[model samples]
Target chain A: MDASKIKQGIHKSKGGLIRSFVTIENGAIKDIDVSGDFFLFPEEAFFKIIKELKGIPAKRGKIQEIIEKTYEKENIQSPGTEPCDFTESIMKALEDT
Target chain B: MNRWRFIDFGLVDIRDMMAMDEAILKGDEGNTFFFWTPKKSIILGYFQKAEVELNLANCKEYTITRRISGGGIAFSDDLGRQINYGVVGTIDNDLFPLDIIGSYKQICGVLIDTLIHYGLNAAFRPINDVVVTPYLNTGTKGARKISGNAQTRWEGKLLQNGTLLLDFDIEEMLRISNIPREKFLDKKIASIREGLTWLDRELGEQRDMEEVKGIMKRKFEERFNVRLKTGKLSEKETALTNSLLPKYYSPEWVFR
Candidate 1:
């Protein structure tokens, strides 16, 4: 039976640095939190997008697609950070804790 | 050429200053540029986890607040005397276009010109920073940081506020803040001072804040091709700021 695990990752965005901690359970994202020194436009949209990540398949492509959908729905402009960076940060967590 | 409303808010609480930024960004009152400074405080970036970035133990004596803008944390001290300016303008405007880095370059160019007016060699580092190269700078490191900027957009407007250090006290800063070691390690500098600078340190003399403000006003007028007509907050802005004040001091906002 797949159990829950927490993982963390960091990425240096063009604008600054961003970090993520994700909780995965049963091959799906149980919860995730993100923080960074990077700039992102429409701060509210960023929150809304991240919230949608819950229950998402704990996979790179799925995470990126969900973030992309949210970005397209809103007029997002993250100068140094791209939507994909969030996925990369989540997936980059090489170790389980 | 355009006319921009300008206000001089000499000194204010950090929470109030941040509230004012949001009030201005959320309003449709055209563009505004305000000169203001905070009393002793620790200002965190929007995305920062305060516990991780700030030394709460040492920060007990300091008031803490967070900015809507995304960037690193900044420490404010009234005695340290920094030239803090806030520019709020419409995103569609040519001066601060929708593009992020481009807008940073264009806006920071005005700041660079201001430093040049005082015979200092200043340059804008990408993302958001206005730096003045130390007179005796050497090696791969060309300049020391004198200013740091952070920006945010609300609706169709943008707010770019930054601080230019008139004087810096690294020891005092380290006491209240926990700057990541990597910041110093990445630069290959012995002490942080080698990578940081201030007006007093560079000029070896004190320049009246008024004189600096006057020069800054001129630079803005020349670079943005706009006249900064002195003004006060609109009734709408005042009320909005008042409404937003309490939230700034709330634990949720400050800790989040």
Candidate 2:
């Protein structure tokens, strides 16, 4: 199970549905893609979080911390969508059971 | 009454349409309302990946593009089958609510009134859609969406663009975009066909686009208590939009 495999998660955020597909290897994120019909202001800022997410332990606290920090640093405004929404989706992908 | 400029940028390339929207947001365009149609394209939400949301094999005939604002994926055509409109103003406009959902309610209220004036039973679904439900006898219970709207804020300004589905080709829409079963399942619908409605289908007749546009113009003025004077893009906006065009057409942007 530790061998890298793809998993998916979907969350209904305040903004809209957010879906994440993660490639996990050894209980850490090898690759992840967050996609959806949600709003994120200054969207160019998202790449920063994506770049930082790699290799982070696949846990709720650890995943959410990364997104929350990015939301603050980038002044992100994702109406109807929150940092935790992204966290929930990523975590679901990590712990899909 | 506060008067806002109304500009119609006749059918143009999708990239130009997006560039123009950004230019108006960044430049000193004052308060303006714009009506534009993109030459056939499937526009992706800001956060969506084309490969995830669209069927690339079916997209060869259409230009795949992304909008500066965030929202669901949608299709557009220059053949007068859809109506696209945007309101650009400093978020401080007296009637524009400062909060996101509040703003949608305010603007979509006008759209709801407009559609109702045409005898369509349009309603605003929270978050961001104008929808209409079929009569009970029709065997469809839930509201089906007819319009898609999204907003983006910058500095002190906000630009919101929404499209009203005066008409649509469901076959083409499904062909271009993958409507996952999970999307319509919550609504108790078996397919995207059941989850969507349009002006033509709801009314059983086509409303002349030009006539509908005229009525929509009046609805905005009436709803906001503002006069929308027919106008053209400002010199500053035109120049900036032209300058920004190259990036939109570049592969890095379209494919990025």
Candidate 3:
């Protein structure tokens, strides 16, 4: 799968768990949507985490870091899913950008 | 050159105490440490909007008062379950910056050292959380967060406080916060569980709350190497607390 294509799919998935992606284009983030069936806290936790990462110099890297940090701190588990893999996919997307 | 005070007022709600602290901060007169009441409450961050941050209906049902601290929201059930601490004095500007991370660690460090004394594995988590590990017989993974601290910095004085969860009701917490139930059902929520642990769980049934408070006070004194003078709010502080009470209790402040 082309990383960009996967990124585009993630950007379009919007809501309902699994996974989500927000694209950083021209120095601004665009296309924030979720894919897969994953559970997040506080409903606002996702937006809050995302908002906290906004306007950073390395937007993608920051997002990945925050997500992983929150996951580790909150003790969130996604069944058989691996957070590292998810992070790698996002990193791949960023590289393609 | 400073006396560290350890107050035991039982379980006072956050609103009344916050009002008292604010009055002292504004120089309304009396400044003292207090430990009062056995009430349960949730204090919102100073900059947080209560409506957006709390579930009003649940709070009303539970008789919890929102507080005036800036950071994340925390729930405290009673004096036994948690103890609140505040420091009021003219802090040297050069000693600490009035920033979030700076003040947070300073106060939390005291509790961290105290917990370590009990032979409990404790560490400070960023932003403002103290955690213990290995799930007190529940076989849970990750560091269990034992304490959550918040601070209010004004003028040259800093008032930092925290909730030491002797025991926590995780399910109730998820229900009270503005977060949805379904969201916490995911494996993500369990990961969060790993990061938190209660003192009661760690010590089993042999722990003493008063003894813990004494240990904390001793560590605080040792950390700052100051004598903690036992005293009550000055008449000025009481008056200030009373005057500010109406405002802090009003919808404008609570909802805002």
**TM-score, chain B, each candidate:** 0.94, 0.93, 0.82
DockQ (Cα-based) per candidate? 0.53, 0.64, 0.04
Rank list by TM-score: 2, 1, 3
Winner of 1 and 2 under DockQ: 2
User: Residues A27-85, candidate 1, lDDT per residue (tens digit)?
Assistant: 88888888778777777787888788999888888888999999999878788678877
lDDT digits (tens) for residues B63-139 of candidate 2: 77778888888797545588899988788646777777888888888789988898766777778888886555243
Please provide TM-scores, in order, for all candidate models, with all chains considered together.
0.89, 0.92, 0.64
TM-score of chain A of each: 0.88, 0.90, 0.47
Top DockQ prediction, candidate number: 2
User: Order the candidates by lDDT, highest first — what do you get?
Assistant: 2, 1, 3
Interface RMSD of each: 1.6, 1.5, 12.9
Of the candidates numbered 2 and 3, which has the greater lDDT value? 2
Comparison by lDDT, 1 against 3, better one? 1
- lDDT, candidate 1, B1-256, per-residue tens: 6899999998888899899889988877788888987788888998887876777988888899999988988898658578889898887748888778888887788778988888888888877988787566653366788888999877777789898888877788877765655455545677666888888888899998888888888888888899999998889999999999998998899997
lDDT of 3 by residue, B1-256 (tens): 7654445656565677778767666663323344443467766554345554567777765544445444556676533476666655455543344444665676688788988887777766655667676536432235567887655555566666676777777767766776433333532445445556677778776467778888878887776677677766667768778998886677776664
